[model samples]
Target chain A: DVKVTQSSRYLVKRTGEKVFLECVQDMDHENMFWYRQDPGLGLRLIYFSYDVKMKEKGDIPEGYSVSREKKERFSLILESASTNQTSMYLCASTTAPTGRNTIYFGEGSWLTVV
Target chain B: AQSVTQPDIHITVSEGASLELRCNYSYGATPYLFWYVQSPGQGLQLLLKYFSGDTLVQGIKGFEAEFKRSQSSFNLRKPSVHWSDAAEYFCAVGEAGGGNKLTFGTGTQLKVEL
Candidate 1:
């Protein structure tokens, strides 16, 4: 079975602080994604990496950046954490260009900015 | 641009009762539809997906979804609800062309009563 693991299950940060959320996948999928889920807002994509060092902005990319230095790891960076930035962050991975391929996700990181 | 919509914000069902969750999409060409479930503080998991061929797709945990092209809808259903079935369900539509980006719905929260 494919498994995606996140670095932190829960985190707390003060305002203006920087935060990092990490994700790793054992399946070696080519595509990885970062998303923030909010009530009534669904899962909005923040960033995605298709290959190592290649990144693309999703619908909601403001105040967030991503790193993909290796094929198995993807990291989400919050430039400046704010109270509004508190959310449940999810990481997902899948094979490229295949519509039939299903995306697998990590357990998610719950961030609380105070 | 492709988008998805899940009409119900929350639904409650007694154990052993039938379940159905609605999803609608707006896309130009044939759309790839998917249903995902997320437990509290967890990432999304693929329940089922519809790419082509058969309209009805079966997923894990006794869940199934049917794609209706004429209505542009993909609704998820379960024969009987269980206590463990309580979770947030999301519907997504995949972009057809080059990249593998998925647009998701707001999600529906399911509450199963024992």
Candidate 2:
């Protein structure tokens, strides 16, 4: 089965602290994405990488950055975490770009900023 | 720009009852539509997608969706509901030409009463 793994399930950080969420996929997908899920607001994309070191901003990319040094790994970085950034972070990957390509997601990492 | 809208915010139905989740989208031409579900403390899972050809599409876990070009809607349906089906369902739309970016709706929270 295609597996997407998020190293952290729960994390708590103080204000202005640096936060890193790691995601890895075994399927060697070419596209990877990071999104934050909040009540009423839903899941908004932060950043996406189509290839190694190539990133693009999504709808809500402002307080976050992403890294894709390798094909299997994608990392979300918050240079200085704020309370507003506290939410469930999800990482997804798709094998290729197609009309019917299915995106697979990890278990998600829940972050709490205090 | 392509966008998706899910009218229902929350829905409650007894187990073994029928379910229908509404999803509407605004796009210039034919858009790639998808339905995803996120369980409690879990990431998103692709339930189904509709690109072209058949208007009715069958998905995993006994879920199906129908795309109506006249109404610009892709609604998900299930004949019977289970307690485990309780989750947040999101409708999304993407550009037609093999693009990786997708705009997601606010999502509908499904509650199955046992």
Candidate 3:
């Protein structure tokens, strides 16, 4: 079975602070994604990495950045955390660009900005 | 651009009752469809996916979905509902070719009553 692990399950940060969310996958998938899950908005992609150090902006990438220094790890960075950024963040990974490939998600990191 | 729509924002069902969640998609051609479930404080889990062939596809937790080309819909169904089945369900659509990005719906919140 594939396993995806998140660095933190819960986090709280003050406004204007920087935050980092880390994710690691044991499956060695080639594609990694970062998304924020919000009520009424569902899951909106923030960023995605197809390979090491290669990143692409998703639909909503305004206040977030991502890092993929290695194949098994992906990190989401918030330049300046704000109350609006408080939400559940999810990390997912997939093997490759296959039609049948399914993305497996980590447990998720809940962030609270005050 | 491809998009997905989940009509029901919230649904209430009694235990052992039938369940159905409506999902509609807007895409140019035959698109890849998927259904995911997210329990409270948990990440999204893929229930099932439909690439091609067999309109009706069985998924985990006794869930199933049907792809209708004419209606451009991929609706999820479950014969009997359980209290543990209460969660948020999301419908997503992706392009047929490789390197396709997934577009998710707003999601439907299911509430199982006693």
Candidate 4:
């Protein structure tokens, strides 16, 4: 079974503080993704990386950025955390692109900005 | 751009009752379809996916989904509902030809009554 790990399970930070959410996948998948899940809005893609050092912005990337310095790791960075940034963040990964590749997700990280 | 729609926001069913969750998609051509479930404070889990071949696909925990090209819908079904099955279900769509991005729906919250 594929496993995606998120370093932080829960965190609370003050406004204007910087936040980091780390994710790592064990299967050597080439594609990694970060998504923000809100109550009514569902899951919105934040950022994704197809290769090491290569990143692309997703639909809701306005207040977030991502780094993929290594193949098995992808990190989400919030320059300045705010109350609105308090939500659940999910990390997912999949093997090289294919018509039928299934993406696996980590347990998730709950961030609370106060 | 591909998109998904989950019409029902919340559904309640008694234990041992039949279950069906509706999902609709908008894409140019054939799109990769997937159904995912997320428990409270946890990451999303893949329930099933439809690429081609089989229109009706079986997934984990006695769940199944059927793809309909004419209606552009993939609806999830279960023969019997259990209280433990209560969770948030999401429907997602991805581009064909090995595209990496996936568009997700807002999600439906299921409540099973014992």
Tell me the TM-score of each prediction against the true structure: 0.97, 0.97, 0.97, 0.97
What is the lDDT for A73 in model 4?
Answer: 98
Model 3 sits at a Cα RMSD from the real structure of: 1.0
Clashing pairs in 4: none
RMSD of each: 1.1, 1.1, 1.0, 1.0
Q: Quote the lDDT for B52 in model 2.
A: 89
The recovered share of true contacts, given per candidate in order, is 0.70, 0.61, 0.55, 0.66
The lDDT for every candidate, in the order shown, is 0.92, 0.92, 0.93, 0.93
- Per-candidate interface DockQ score: 0.71, 0.68, 0.67, 0.72
Q: Please report the candidate that would top DockQ against the real structure.
A: 4
Off by over 4 Å in 2: none
The order by descending lDDT is: 4, 3, 2, 1
lDDT of 1 by residue, A1-114 (tens): 999999899999999998999999999899999989899999999999999999999999999999999999999999899899999999999999635579999998999999
Over A58-109, each residue of candidate 3 has an lDDT whose tens digit, in order, gives: 9999999999999999999999999999999999999778345898999999
Clashes of each: 0, 0, 0, 0
Candidate 1 lDDT (Cα, 0 to 1)? 0.92
